[model samples]
Target: MPTIIMTKWPVKLDGSVRSKAMAFLQKLSHDDTTPGLHVEPIGGSADDRVRTGRVDQFWRAVMFRLDGNNERHYVIHGVWPHDDAITVARSVSLTVNPINGLPQIEAASPSVASAGATAPAPSALSSESAPAAISPAGSEPAAPSTPAQPAPPSEASPAPAPSEPLLVRLGRTRTELTDRLGLSADIADHALSAPNQDAITELAARHEGWIGMALIGLAVGESIESIVESLELDQPHPSSGSQEADLLEALRRPAARAQFSFIEDQEELRQVIDHGDFGAWRVFLHPMQRRYVEKSYSGPFRLSGGAGTGKTVVLVHRARALARRNPQARIVLTTFTTNLAGALRDGLAQLDARVPQVTGLGDEGIYVAGVDALASAVIRAAGADVGDAVRAVLGEDRSQPNGRTTSAGWREVLDGASTSLPPEIAHESFLAAEYALVVLPNRVTSEAGYRRVRRPGRGLALDRAKRDAVWSLIAAYRAQNRVEGTLDFAEAAAVAAAWLETAGSLADHVLVDEGQDLSPAHWQLLRAVVGDGPDDLFIAEDSHQRIYGPRTVLSRYGIKVVGRSQRLTLNYRTTAQNLRYAMSILEGADYVDLEEQPESTGYRSARSGPAPTIVPADSLSAELDEVAKQVGNWVSAGTEPSSIAVLAGDRFHCERLARGLAERGVAAAHVEREQPPKDRVAVMTMHRAKGTEFAKVVLADTGATSAERDRLESLDGSARADTELRRRSLTYVAATRARDELAVIQREGRRA
Candidate 1:
């Protein structure tokens, strides 16, 4: 069978054109000789391989045809009118990136590439002709002979201030781009000519293949190695010793997979067409993301990136890849919340409907569940109930929660018991953190064990007397839960972990999403279920987006990804304008990943758009009124109503926004647990909005003070700082949910 590649799948189309394109691909894949297809060559094309096929009476498919001895490959570049199709085919040619040696679509004639002026002869730069433009590693870059002016403010300043030099971004020079990394002299000279970061971004927007990616990486202050890694330019091409990879062999690499996909069957082609750009990540992921999904690891592995970098997409694809690689392997895919786990399950199905999924802890297929749900499954698989588990932690008072967290029991104990603990430490946040991080994970049953236990990363220091007071409260809390026969999430997970340790491995591999939200006890439970070997655990998380869950060090929980962790630096979802807005939320905040190192890198979005709008409104009514107007404008501009979302900090505001939309004669639905229906606008809280995206988003604030945001202002010292950071992250999360446009309506009356 011939391979069908969707190169640069275009979403810009009318319904008629979209349908025609899909029909064209469907027929071309199954039988290329169909009468309507009319596949043939374009006479005046710069590249003779260029061909045009009939999509409809008015539309034509501009593509490249490669005929092999056994089969042919159809590479669809775009769908356009007849004249445009011929023009594009004539201008385009397939060639290899001189630096990375990856296949790319080049528009200039091969003569231009061959000329010694624009670039070197394929592999080597003219040794003595082009002077070395940089110094050795670990030293300040040598300045160009002619002094350069300072960069202007408002440039892409994610990495450093605009006052810094741009031609030598991240201190990388022409010699580094050409020799150490990979870039042709012409491209290297072009990047070095850019006046500032803004210029680099503008240059990236116009170019394709490795040129755009390499330029953006330079602007972001990415290291030479990271830029290579980010581009997946380091991928092993079949024609390694030659100038470039063969068309067929190049398609097999992650580099090619970023903009191209090989259709295996008709169903996949249909699904890819149906989802379009929304599902593009599944089919066209950057080589870096594909690396995380396809690469093998000695132990647990971690993948982190800022919002919209396709971490979840990688996780979903990795899950399917793992299942297909080992049919008999028992895999567990889990997260912190039930809603997120459900999202993962839906993602797996959307990725490939044939992925084998099972419910129990069976030694076959993949089991998708929340960590708590997995604990429940583990207990049941061991012929135990929730009430019977957690005996080690709760002792005689141990009981099952019916799957609900007994966290409230801690507050109840505080109200019932008497102590002089500090007000900050007396709060539920402090107490819960102590129990989950120190007590439960350490398995401290008595006050004596708690006193002897070391609190490694706990923010506050507890003296013996203070420890006694905390233990008294803990003892009372356990006593109440013991009598009620209820276990909080931490205790239940602890019990499950203990059981799994004794029962041996219950899962061959485990993949975790939103991993930053899980507690330490949850991590222990996860480690217990999976065997400790190759491909043991795969975690996808972004510390900047961690709105829920604790700050945990995975190595402390025995799931080490220290040397195995990698980050994706290019965002595929949010527009560059909105991405700058989203990143502004974390401007001064310090956040660390599961590895516990300060996040040092920044990500650049692939798309660019208008800057996000911020409206300051006095009342809930005014905010919603503006939101309604914005929604109307978006819909009138051809964006689907179902592709718009209104997000808030809490459920009350979400409901109010939904009601306000209704009063304004607009269709809107309140979303809580599940995704909203496709026919109406969806209104949901920021927390629930995670893992979801829309074409346009309106972040509206009602008069009600959110519990989480209120906590941020109410606390003091380190605790308050942490709460404020998470609050910033929540707004960042809601903002990034917008794929195209975003509007933030601040309720001045509520906070100001």
Candidate 2:
């Protein structure tokens, strides 16, 4: 069997041509010299290295037969028409540079000279040289640089007229660039010898994180100091002793091979060639992301980063990697919400279609589901009814106002408890906080245990009498719930945890995503389902994006992640300006991970975009009017309304905005766990905005009024602090969802 490398050209070919190329490659992989393919060499090319093979009457594939030392491999460059294929084979040059020991491709045509001089040799500048001026098989080199000569006054700030149609030649020898900048020889050679600066510039622009390295400065016209700074940040103090070895290693790196791939598995090759998705998983991943997916862990591992940092990407790949490594391993991948779980499941199908589907938890190749859903399944599998718990906690009908239940609704339970307490006792908010943050998390089964525990972060000190009084109220509520056969979500998780302790582990590996938003009981349940061993558990979370559930400490739940953790810094989704605006919303708020580690202070994005628009109107109608106008303008400008999300502070506002938009003749649909129709505008609350993103976001009236703030301030100190923190976090999460543009619409003079 011979090694077959696939370049990006086939992916760009017409569908019929691509199919032909894939079929031809499949045959060539089994036998290098497959008969009837009519592989013929071009006579004019140096060394006759390039060859053309017949795909059919109309299509032809161009390939480079690399033969050196004992190694022989074939690189399929492209598929095109017969004439185009032959022309490409004749004009292209393929060679393995002895200095770097990596294969190089270039056009045989002369370099497009800048100013007066010709470009230098490959050995003169960088290790990786740019290919020649000959265009790709079916394409043509961009119309020559031809610096703008002059322009009429109608154009503002048009390109400056070149003094003599060209300035001093931009080209330099690899040796000259390397000696002057003190950079590695390979990098220098690549800058000086490459013929297509435009191609390199485009790559740099697309992958900003790799701008400083990869000889990006040469293409983007950056100074040496700036390139050095970027390289330093990418890999501070690169310490390889052998430049040639470093270049070889770099060639094999995941980041370097992101744009090209050599397929070894015939099945995987078929998937890519059939779908033309060459950049899918296994290729095109950032080096850091690949590390998170493949690194071996001694215990549980956690990958934390902000939204769009590829945390979920890592989780999906890790699960597939585990399943592939251990064919019989029972792997479970879960997230906090059902929406994200669905997205993960879809991603898995694309990543590795061969992964077998299990019936449910405890019976599978890989299980993908929401944590709550998994808990319910686990409880049912144990012959325990989870609905009984829910009915017991809420009424038999779960009759709560607005068809909802929340910790804030605990005021009703506090009312029952407050009757027995002194007049000086804090309001229902404080008691609710005491129950949720401290009492339930610690699982205090007795009055004595509750009284002995020190209340951390709780400002109101309680005497023995006060503590007993609070306990009596809690006991009463629990007794009613028990008699009613009801269990709240939190209690259901707790019950699941208790059952798991007695039932033993459910799977070999349990992966948790969006872990920061899970409740304490949820964590406890997760802890119980996986044994303490290598790869027992994996978590992907970001505290800053935590929008729901109580803040939990993993150590208390026996899920320690102190030593096994990685933080991803590069953000692939949100633009730099949008990220900064999102960060501003979280300003002054401190967030810590489950292990109590402060977040990375250096968190930043390299992708830059326009600053968010902040609109302030004097009245509610005025604000809505502005929002509608902006939304209409965006739609007129060719932005898909589905790609634009209009989020409000609460559900009521969301409904109001939707109605207003409809009245104005704009089609709007309320967004939920499931997505809205493609043609309709999406309207949702900030809380519902979790685990989602949009290309454009319109945050209409997110801030509360002075009266609302006053009411919040009236709550107990602990309740007020927690409420405010969660609110701020919600806004931050919403703001960060905008990838390209953000607009914050609010009533003028309203208190935030």
Candidate 3:
């Protein structure tokens, strides 16, 4: 069957024209010869290689038909009016750049000598000989007349000369761009021509391929190696097939996928039409992210990056990829919370609704749920076999242990434990960490096991006597929890892991998002659910976004990711201004990742915007009023109400902000676990907004953080440090969620 590579450039079209274009794509994908498509050759193009298909009476979709031995591939350039479509065809340049051997498709201004119009007649394979003038990178118009073809892309600017938005300060030589970095001569010259960093960013924004990614990555100080690994340009494809077939293969390259969407079948074409242009464009994956999604690891692989770095995006795509590759594989896609899992499920559906989804674990297809949900599923799957684990948490009765998630349960148990021991050994917080990090994860049921357990990442150490004391308290907590019918999420995971280890469950692959927040029991459960093997565990974590738990070492639970880790440093969700402010929140904190490696949260953003605004209002009440006005202004300026948010420190504060906005007649909804409705401004705590983002954020200080900080200050040693780390991370998480704008509301000297 013939393939269709839809150009994903920013095309603007009216509802009518867009509808017609969708119909044209559907018709073309099913049968190019369909009468209404009018897949006729365009005039003044060499060999009649470029053609125009009828989108409607006035608009036409221009494309290039590449013929293989037994197949044909049609690449739709854009939709334009007849006269404009003809000119646009003349402006189209599809070539495999000689430097990298990767296919390139772009549209130039009609005034510019388009390579397609001037090059040799035609080739069945690569458009390698075509050489369009390359200009310094810059942004371009979204579309033409009537939600039209993207305005002749700015990539078609004047030929590279002294370079605008120049990158002279970076001192990147042509050899580095070409031989070393794999950029085409034209693209290298374009980067060299730029006058400043913004030019590089502008060019990158317009190109949608290596040139844009490379320049922006370099502009933001990413190493050439880092950029190359993420782009996956280093992978060599030995060319043995017919030139035309090779061209098709080239589109499958990691680099080309960043720009083109190859429609697999009619259903995908339907999805393309339904998503329209921008929505489909949103699903494009960063090359490195795609790399993680597709690569097979010996055991567990970890992908780490700062907030908004697309870790979750990678996990979602990986789930689909793994499912497609292993049809019968039992794959579990999980995260720390049920809401995040729901978000992942929705994202997967949006990505490709065709991917199979199953409700329970071990069945074919994918099982999506929170980590605890996964644990519960494992427990439920091995119902009778899971009695031992149930007993571990529920004591003798082995009945359902249901109460608060053990946070309150731990306090209750601590309130009744012997108080004669040292504060560190007797504290509820200490016991919680010890149980989660050392005891629960290790399945330490007795004092001997607790004493022997290796607490690698724990900030404090316990002697034999201290261990005995802690074990006694843990015994009491479990006994009390069994009476109260209460079980912690971590305890459930521990029990589930133990059951899986003994019974050997059926999960083949597990993809975890927000891997850092998962407790020790969760890690052990994941390890057992999918015992270490080829492509077993794929975790996406950002320690800088570790808003909940302390640092975890995956090695302890046999979920090692030491040598199999990839770090993404580019922030895709925020502007440089917001990212900088977010990183500043973790200035002095050094984070050791799950592998015990010192991790840096330093990241560079592709886009630049206004520096984060600090709204140091006189008081919390005034702050709320100012925030309402700012959100009102943003909504008035055309930002979606849901895209505008006022993030507070807690639920109480979030509700207060929502009421404050409502009183001011700015519609706001306080969201907890559910998604914020599109018609209302999202008033949410910073914690609830962790996996989500906003276009404009008012990070209000209701003075909620001060009390926690004051309480943590009284904590000694590692407790104080861990609490402070999470506090900063929470603030960072909130600040970074702002894609374009961040306004901080502070009444005193503290971060909101």
TM-score of each: 0.85, 0.75, 0.87
Task: Please report how far candidate 2 places residue 666 from its true position, in Å.
Answer: 3.3
Ranking the candidates on lDDT from highest down gives 1, 3, 2
Which is the leading candidate under lDDT?
1
Sorted by TM-score, highest first, which candidate order results? Answer: 3, 1, 2
* Residue pair clashes in candidate 1: 386-400, 387-400, 397-482
**Per-residue lDDT for 1-752 in model 1, tens only?**
55687765332455556667887888899888887789988887777877889988777887778775468888777666666566667777766555565666665643322111122132211111111111110001111111111212333334544564586645667888887556667667777777666566666655544556677787777788877766666744546442312676666666667666777788888776664431244576666777777888999999888877777777778888998898888989888788878877877775787788897786599899998988877777766543344666555545454445555777787787778987788877888888988999888988899999999878788999999999988888777776776677777788888777777878889999888888888999999999799999999888998888778899988998878888777876676777888887779889988989998547787666556777778776788898898877776655567778899878987888899899998899999987676778889999998877776788887233665456665554667777777878888888888766778777874651
State how far residue 261 of model 1 sits from its true place (Å): 2.1
Evaluation by lDDT, superior candidate among 2 and 3: 3
For model 3, residues 461-516, the per-residue Cα lDDT tens digits are 77777778778888888777666665678877878887787888678998999988
The C-alpha local distance difference test score for the whole of candidate 1 amounts to: 0.72
Q: Candidate 1: list runs displaced more than 4 Å.
A: 97-100, 108-199, 206-208, 223-229, 232-245, 273-279, 385-389, 397-407, 702-716, 749-752
Evaluate residue 698 in candidate 1 and report its C-alpha lDDT on the 0 to 100 scale. 86
Please count the clashing residue pairs in each candidate, in the order shown.
3, 26, 17
Using TM-score as the yardstick, the better of models 1 and 3 is: 3
Candidate 2 stretches greater than 4 Å from native? 1-203, 206-251, 264-266, 273-278, 384-409, 415-417, 420-433, 457-460
TM-score, cand. 2: 0.75
Task: Looking at model 3, report the run of 10 residues with the lowest lDDT sum.
Answer: 132-141
